[model samples]
Target: MTPGRPDPARRRWRRIAVVTAVVLALAGANGPWLYRFGSEKYHAYRIDRPEYKARNGRWEIVEFPEGYRQNTIHAALLRTGKVLLVAGSGNDQENFDARRFDTRVWDPVKGTVKKVPTPSDLFCTGHTQLADGNLLIAGGTQRYEKLKGDVTKAGGLMVVHNENPDKPMTIEAGTRFTGRKNGKTFVAQDAVLVPRARKRFDPETGRFLGNDAGLSRVYVEAERRGARHETGAEDNYRVQGLRGADARNTYGIAQKLALDKKDFQGIRDAYEFDPVAERYVKVDPMKEARWYPTLTTLSDGKVLSVSGLDEVGQLVPGKNEVYDPATRSWEYTGKERQFPTYPALFLTQSGKVFYSGSNAGYGPADKGRDPGVWDVRTNEFTKVPGMSDPDRLETSGTVLLPPAQDEKYLVIGGGGVGESRASTRRTRLVDLRAKNPRFTDGPSLGRGTRYPQSSILPDDTVLVSGGSEDYRGRSGSDILEARLYDPDRNSFRRVADPLVGRNYHAGSLLLPDGRVMFFGSDPLFADPANSRPGVFEQRIEVYTPPYLYRGGRPVVEGGPGTLRRGGTAVFRSPDAARLETARLIRPSASTHVTDVDQRSIALGLERTAGGVEVTVPKNRNLVQPGWYMLFLTDRDGVPSTARWVRVP
Candidate 1:
């Protein structure tokens, strides 16, 4: 050993010794609990521990990378069939430093991350992979710095220049605007990202204590950065991500709204891009101009852009505009959606748009409206069903997480931002299979907060990444906590946080490997140190299941394995929690799970108090032999736990 410290060889030995001790301790967390560990799906097996099995309830942040630019991820694509992945970043110019806008594409196999080139020197709001495999991104500048108001859209409210009331906070003057590097703009900004909350327990009293579930609050105040000047020019805008439902057509539509405030005449047009041809063509302009709307493609091949910043000057009520790609002209369709304001439009497998989560007024309710959903097919404007969760503001607040499936919408974390309730920090699980699909509040975050975006894997497990939480009566972001949900178990567990902070960003999907991709975004302006809203990004990230490294359990912990066609296994049920009853698991192992786009083989289950008993299906006689484990979990509805059995 060295005089003050151990030598490198000694340090290495010490690390090994520590790891061995940890492994031994984990093996004894409960007791020696072994059963056949094998599943037909992946042909794997292992042992089980109550503590470890419980860990599977949420994402396990096995590892994390360094903190990159000060931005949120907007788009991400895992390079399927390959080891690398690409992610796009969108930095908020008004609140973040511009430098964070740097783009970062990552290599999962090599464990290296780098940058990629964006098509334009502008902020990208949406991104997706084309059918042909190229990345498609769309966005416009906030009309700050080198970008002029004449050619760019204003981000904030200036009653005189206000075009959309739903989002009243308008971009001040672009003439005085500089890149987000100057650090001089936060002085008067008032616009804010929503907040979150958390739940805690008094250590001494052992009583539940509630708190905000978020990071520090950073308000955005609008200020004129340059002298006022106006020129007669044109402004163009980009729409949301890809819209065409069919893969063969590989076609998408984006809106380009040209507004010349000097002339008070607004121009609206749509552009069609052919991924196969690698080109873009302009479609006809609509009779009316709409902003902050959702464009959905129908099963009948019709494309509908619903409820936008209406030119008629009404904020709550909205008109639907239908575009016949073949016809090339936008037909003023019927008034399908009355309160179509900034709605999250998700396309269902049946070619219908699953609409949810929306802002009612151009501004907050006190200023006008709250949030809701409008169905276009039924011309429905009635109050949304199943989404009447209580909020602090009494507004309709729905935690719009990623889609659980083409048939189901996923709702993860959320705060009382739009609610009028005392319990502001909460998570939710919204099963969208009902006639009046709404939500069932999940376990409270023990605080009030909302995780805006979550990544849903093929297995139906959800990865809730970033969002805002309430902290110490102030505001904060949910960038620190993550959770996982297993329908079989119907429970949520605390997981590891991403290495860095991210909120109000999009989660992009990468196929084949089924890994998670995270793009970046920026919420602060002035000080490009963290981002470049209209410029660049420095990193991208991918989340792979630590299955191989986990050594056992497909996140089950204590132990798990693959099941064979003729193998039998056993499992012990876990105890109940606060009156929560448990579900029994049988034939614990799954032999044939689905592929990236398919389903997994279904096995049978039995119940036990310490755990569960597992068995294989009779048809397994024709199946191949392999290792597998049974999994059990409980959904609060029936208070039953889902159990997994191994067949190794």
Candidate 2:
């Protein structure tokens, strides 16, 4: 070949080399795409590939058949396989009064919602499951306030105490006053309460009551003092005798006015809901009226109530009490254990309660916000150290990690205290079995969230879903994506996202079939008008994890309907040889990121002739007395539909 040009044979070789180099470069550019396609189409079909099998789980959402009349502020899984949804006033006082259905029993199988009467406003309350399989719902709002303009027009006459006589006893237009007549209370839309000063009248000693008799005397005295003539009144003081009774006893003007008109107050009402009877039986009320108290069932079946706003709407002091089912009354524990409102407490195997460092909004941040183990017997608190971002975990989701044998707890995302509007993405786990028992970092969520729901799965994985990045779930803050946390790997994998966005007042619970139901979102704090469509989330959605899609679910054919603690039970399963594990999950009473009674117990399984012999733990702490869903999973991690078994 020439220096600058090549002969035919040499030129052919040069062209081949250039083509070869171009082909190599193109392959490198598209290599990842080709590998991905091959892995998905071919390698994924290889059942033995662990990596492919790990990616099999997905999320499925199903809408409810009907929506709730009121916003669902609280939700729980009842023992009858029904869902109990409670929403007192549902944030809309007017609408709630119109409909008057604050509580409902939703049967998922029947696709129906039955309204149940609620004695008090359960707008913001706490609840837990009792050992006798009853739901103990405690505390709630006594009433809700409405603006004068929002209420009907019915004004009461008031004696004007015009300190300045020069100014006419002029009632400003649009001034509001409440009046009572003929056993009915009315609001005065055009006048305010103004009483004139009297030489003999000691306002302090008057003890001005809210009744008509008391108000009529003031009107008569004002008339005697020529108050009507001075004002040139067209309408006489039409103060009919006060017919209504005052809810409170007080002397001050503000106090008297509050008594005259209804006002919101926290209540001491406590009751047990019987799912079978579909009714609420009155229980002994708490010693102090509570608005947002947490009720945790002890291992012995007694319930301990802690932290809430009192009847006067003030935070109750650290004093706590335990409820005895035998007596059907609450006995002051004599221990003043103060915890934040709706503190997430878990009963340990030793009967001690573990404050999971998670609390519902409302309490001194320092008092009960610290993660600790509280001994009810000794009234001693052992604080767990090393928890990051502990102060602002309000509305955060928490769970006693599965395989109850492992005493580990995980606290998920939450928001800051007192309208801080800041959400957290940090997660932490504390192993109670550890010697020091300090919280350590777990996997962090991709984004900060508040009000996330953590559901423990039969396969020992935790599914976290639904929360907002902001306090009240402002737009763009709704966390729609769901994730699964695998304990074996200590990692989170993104799953399917629920179409609806949930925030404050949202709730979730695992069902018997291993699916999780997400319901009850009150983003606008129950204001239906300001809430955008779908924000209140009256409709329910069921999330089916990917494991359900895999074929060949283990079949649990026969098992004892009732098993005693530390008892031996034989379960017949078609795939006994392939059965890898069995679990007993307590039905949860969950609301406000607080699941007081839910737990998972891993059963010891031994392959029998045609089935498996499962040994239930004798430890009441591990498996408390209640109804639990028993599930068996195969080697592929596919769990059978759970069977409800009562542990007496």
Winning candidate number (lDDT)? 2
lDDT: worst 10-residue window of model 1:
587-596
RMSD (Å) per prediction? 20.6, 11.9
The true-versus-predicted C-alpha distance at residue 398 of model 1, in Å, is 7.4
Which 10-residue window in model 2 sums to the lowest lDDT? 215-224
lDDT of candidate 1 over 1-648, digit per residue (tens): 558977899789999999999988976773434222224222221213333433432222313255433333333332222212222224343432443334444444555544444333223222222222333232222222323355333222211121221222222222222222222221212222222334568999989765433321111222433322221223221111313331111111111112322111112445443323333345575544443343444444455655544322233245567766557677766654443344445444433444444332232443313323335566544334454343332211233222222244433433343322233454445555557656565655554443334544434455555544432112333345556655556666665445444433333333333455554433332233423322322344555433212332221223234444434444443432212221111111000000011112334454444444444443321121221112333332222212232232
Model 1 misplacement above 4 A: 1-73, 76-293, 307-317, 322-331, 336-342, 348-352, 358-375, 386-408, 415-423, 429-432, 435-438, 470-478, 506-511, 521-538, 546-648
lDDT (Cα, tens digit) per residue for candidate 2, span 357-471: 7887787766668889999988999999998887768888889998877988889988889678788899989899998999888998978889988889998998888788877
TM-score of each candidate?
0.46, 0.74
Error (Å) of candidate 1 at residue 199 is 65
